[model samples]
Target: MADAADGARTPAARLRALLAAAPADGPVLAPGAYDALSARLVADAGFSCVYMTGFGTTASLIGQPDIGLLGAAEMADNARRIAAVIGDVPLIADADTGYGNALNVARTVDTYERAGVAGIQLEDQVTPKRCGHMGGKEVISTAEMAGKIRAACEARRDPDTVIIARTDAVATDGVDEALDRARAYRDAGADVLFVEAPTGEADIEKIAGALAGGTPLLFNWAEGGRTPPLTLPRLRELGFSLVLYPIGTLLAATAGVRSLLETLRRDGTPAAALGSPQQMTLPGFDEFTELVGLSAIREREARYS
Candidate 1:
């Protein structure tokens, strides 16, 4: 029997349920989180799910771009940490190129499954894959990517853990070929299809129309990237089952930190920065402490004493 302390459903189960129900209602809007704090905020704001973005994770962890700088271990470790804090909220993580080939893809899936992610997204770009929105991207052959997708599906212990197959062929190949690659991945047992960096509305519709039949489609709402921004309803109308805002919070935090630092440098204090309502209004110190579960820690400490 399962432990009484454990919830009735595992995180994977919950995420699967969410994905299954998404098509009927609308797209599942998952905002990306770079760290535990950001994930907590995302959950606190009442989002049903979170996406662990590799781009934002690279920037947050090492202050680097998403040019495949992170290894499988680093990405898995980051997912584990974020999963620890977000409670029951589902995390859909980016697994870039599955680190290597078919065997590597299996290991990547296993690591992410153990790390408590509900979904893992693997792209078709080469081992050292660049960001989907970036230029000069190249993808592996269709058969090779299909093999990795099959490997990913075979490796996951949970049947409910979703495997997303992202094809970056829209830039290297065209939208039509990207759609063809998506079909191959779908046939290989990918739970979701992501045709990355679709340039315009027509391409987006084409992707949705071609692949959104039995398999769910994922739309990358990468702000200021190659893809044009569309509203959630518009994306839903386009038949996308999941929409990921991969760096909205990260970008906001970047701008906020810069503003605060500039204010502090100019005034020799942060008070002026905090005074404006238009400026970032941070939670009070005590509230932030509570947000981080200081009260729970104190209660446990008292019980021990």
Candidate 2:
């Protein structure tokens, strides 16, 4: 039902609808996107939620990794642009490590709330973040992360804006330690729990089963981050509220673009691409031309008046 004219609609209303319309008895599939066009594509694909992946944003925008390079302002600016086009669809943004400590988390929450994200995931990795489920992964004391969780809870303007506390201590420390931190984080008022990078099936089961009772959970389906990938149904069976396919869109786009470039090199043009505007049907082109004609009529009327 969405169209170009619907651009002026507020994000909150659309977001609410998306949240309400998610599969009633099953886990939702949320895909990650970095920019506005990708966000729109995700929405158009009938995805109920769109995740603003930190990795994708870093790599796509600045050609970097999930390190601490992108600052709050830069991330917020990018979020605003994506949220602008996606019309809410419940954006679950990746606020990696809060960009700093507890004090920084307060500011991060304030700014992200203003950017109109529906939720945020804050991790326990002590700043200067390394990928979770990877070596050299370090975590702050549970007390420190709890303080940041509290800060995040206090900072949110909307009660519905979920704060997901991600504990990276599973890889850094023992599972017991990570569980301890998750308990403290939940007690500190996180709406969801993201226990990061649980490697094997047993670990995944332990994490999922342990958190299934009272808290909602999120699972990452990254290709090679630290954990193994599972199909959507498997994730749902494990009691995950959302499964984020963070890099699949980007990977597909990257491959397509690469192929297009190679084709252009070999041939004279990217001629076989059906996705191009050149492939539009006659009626489709006519409808597009009609819109232009309507716009020109409005412009002429405005000029005379």
Q: What TM-score, computed on C-alpha atoms, does each candidate reach?
A: 0.95, 0.83
lDDT of 2: 0.77
User: Candidate 1, which segments miss by more than 4 Å at Cα?
Assistant: 1-8, 276-280
lDDT of 2 by residue, 245-280 (tens): 888788888887887788778887655543457563
Candidate 1 lDDT by residue in tens digits, 1-305: 12221343877777666666676678888999999899999988988889999999999999999999999999999999999999888899999999998999999999999999999999999869888999989889999999999999999899989999999999998999998999999999999999999999888888888886789899999989989899888887887888999999999999989989998999999887667555547666777899999999999999999
Which candidate gets the maximum lDDT versus the true structure? Answer: 1
Model 1: how far residue 120 lies from native, Å: 0.3
For model 1, what is the alpha-carbon lDDT of residue 220? 93
Worst 10 residues of 1 by lDDT: 1-10
